[model samples]
Target: MTEQFGLFDARGLQPADAAAPPLCVRESRRARRLTLRVLPPHTLELVVPHGARAADVAAFVHRHRRWIERARREIASHYSLAQDRLPTRIALRAIDQSWLVRYESEPQAPPRVRVLGDELEVRTRDASNRGADAALRAWLCDQASYHLTPWVLREADLVGRRPSRVQVRLQRTRWGSCSSSGTLSLNAALMFLAPAVVRYLLIHELCHLISLNHSQRFWDAVERFEPNYEALDRQLTEAWADIPVWAHPDARRR
Candidate 1:
């Protein structure tokens, strides 16, 4: 079970400084020690192990206050708070396509998105950014499903391994995953990565059909298909910075 606590709670913990960003404390049964995470766009999460004393948790935060501030600064440097607003253009690099986004307001009507020649037209009720963002995200998922599903299928055939099903979604922490039952899941955010990087990710997941764990044999299979897997894997990790802030999983939360 997990529970969340705000900056100031009833546990007699020290109150957070007035200028400090929001802090969320979560209790985890599996955690052996307190760990801190600086989530993107400005949220701090502290994971507390079960049965931790409130005083200890407070001291932990106090001890790491400077580190927290530094991490926040790094995130701010990479992501501008102003970019949280609606996007005017989107570039799907994997497909080598760029799209212009146009917004139309319709009072009391449901949000909708349409794809024109090189543009995406979003119609939303009240013209709110939230509604438009949702519509665009839905459209993005559809686009991912349309392109990534077939791409995974073709790659599976080439690798001489097949999956029971392929799914595309807007995942936050993973590029792709394969289950023991042969279900392959791909992140919709792959659309923002380079074509070569996307192909490498697909190959990485398909290779899992041979070995679920990252054992020596699993890595051997990956190298067999992609000799430069190490470099491509590094590129995938760094590509997150290139993704539009609006498409991030935490964007809507802000």
Candidate 2:
């Protein structure tokens, strides 16, 4: 369903006081309960089960105002776009590769990107952060595709499982997913994770081929392949902060 949004208002809220951020309301049939997501750069998202009321959502946000403020402060403390500008060098420990980034601008030059042994170069007429970030992201996707695809396939083969296809894309809040059809979609951001963590993610998804849901059987399968899966699973949650802000467009916006 299309996302909807609304302004939050309540009794005793003063007009002169600071206004709350815009609320993005999403209705999900699969959502069994209302949940709040306070994302980086101060975006507030509310996921409501189908048929939830606006008043219910507003009340939920209102009750959690203090928590939201604290969460935003925590995020601000950890991240600043000024410190998150595009990097001159990026290392992917998971893939054992590093890139030396160079941005070159020329008058009337068409935007282009090239990755040659350990160097990623972007040429554009406009040398703005946005342009450079976009170019770098495209290159990262290519690298993720080239590296992640083969690694996942090889691991799947060893486990005697096969996916119909694999796709690499920039995903927020997930490492990978395997559909019932056996198609696996991996987050390109896996390139930022550690090698062991990457392998655990592949095994986690591969097990889904046997059990689409995260049931006990799935956990058993994952543990069979990677005994250290639990620790790596915990690390995945905190991995987003380790990713350079330029790689995630949302984190880049301040």
Candidate 3:
């Protein structure tokens, strides 16, 4: 799941192109801003201050298309999702072993999935145009709560600790994470997996609260909660690879 558009994202894409809906996500650092995030499915994001015009961002993207495209090409997901249309269904093979495929669609949308019994399943319904992305994103957040809450509590109880809060949201890079202040951030994407796999992410993040690093002790902490952490980690390690074709980073904004 790649955000084709957002506030100040810095990925370079021109809306004029019927090939792909391009937009940029803005990222700033040290008050000197010029970072653009080309979102997945291939697009550009322009990084600017709080008050920036989309038109100005578009110009910036036009200025940096080469760098962005290079980065997009480096990311394997973009290559996989080069051709797609809005509100469409796409079938693809997931590189992750946990689940063979996924159906990204609107909330409570029809069962776009057709299970052929273990072979593989992928039914994607695009809502990128009419806020289907928003709908799918909301469902993903709720699903994360439904799946991760108990798992978090279970791990906390085992170590005689309780989490002060749980945060579930979309993150392009991380599957699950935890903070030292007893707050946990989990990727809503876990909803795509079976319950067992979700449990693995829970223990892994909670253990971070204790060890704070991926040391042997941290792994041991994870092992204490789920003995098969290594195996589960292996499964999750390569997940999210089946994300569909989108676009490449705009050449102007990298």
Candidate 4:
């Protein structure tokens, strides 16, 4: 047996049935677009093409109640988080001879960056939603520009090389990259890293302003600029597991 209820909100009404029938769900209405998103634990996010009626969508949801709930319930159990979630923090050393940690909040509180005394706050409105990664990425880029730019420029000048641009992104893959066009891109995640590692990555990218490929020449250049870089590079490589999601091969050894 399924429960039936009407969903009321500022937008209007919707169908809320724990057990409904199988009906064709339409999302997009105005344009030639239609898709169904199962909001687990028993809800369908229907995207209708423009000019679609909510009544029709609600009816559709009501028609497919049981099947939708069954499917969504399983999904929800795997991914859904409670309203009150704890922050996961990582201890890091700041450049100003200070220690800090960065943390992410689930059901985040709007997009904002804050330094609560010594803690670096990366607040996302919804860690379970789309904008969390992007918001953090933007904040990190801003932080990188502010903290790394002076150092990068100084090194560029010292090395007699000029960079064309600096870009930042959410890279689950690599760290910094240097293109043949004198453009440099850095991982926004680096903001969560120790300042020393961040500085080393910056110098690594600037070194690429000379050698696009990693070779003995590049190593020599890196060592020339930052002696003891080998040890720093090793540290950076080991720090990959600092991000819980990244599956580092050596992470298990630690």
Residue-by-residue lDDT tens digits, candidate 3, 1-254:
11122344443353434333344343222225556654443434444644456677667667877766565555434443433332233222111233233445555554343435443233344433333334334544564576567767886788666777988776654566666677878776666555566778777777777775565797788788799876676566445443332211121111
Q: Which stretches of candidate 4 lie over 4 Å from their true place?
A: 1-137, 244-254
Off by over 4 Å in 1: 1-80
TM-score, cand. 1 vs. native = 0.72
lDDT for model 3 comes to 0.52
TM-scores vs. true structure, each candidate: 0.72, 0.72, 0.51, 0.50
Point out the higher-scoring one by lDDT: 1 or 4.
1
Each candidate's number of clashing pairs is 0, 0, 42, 15
Candidates arranged by lDDT, highest first:
1, 2, 4, 3
Task: List residue ranges in candidate 3 displaced over 4 A.
Answer: 1-71, 74-129, 242-254
Q: What is the C-alpha lDDT of each candidate?
A: 0.73, 0.69, 0.52, 0.53
Q: Which residue runs does candidate 2 get wrong by more than 4 Å?
A: 1-62, 73-80, 251-254
Q: C-alpha displacement of 150 in model 3, angstroms?
A: 3.1
lDDT of 1 by residue, 170-249 (tens): 86546777888899888898998999999998998888898875657977998998999888877875565566667765
**lDDT of model 3 at position 121:** 37
By summed lDDT, the worst window of 10 consecutive residues in model 3 runs over 245-254
**Total clashing pairs in model 4:** 15
Q: Residue 234 CA error for candidate 1 (Å)?
A: 0.3
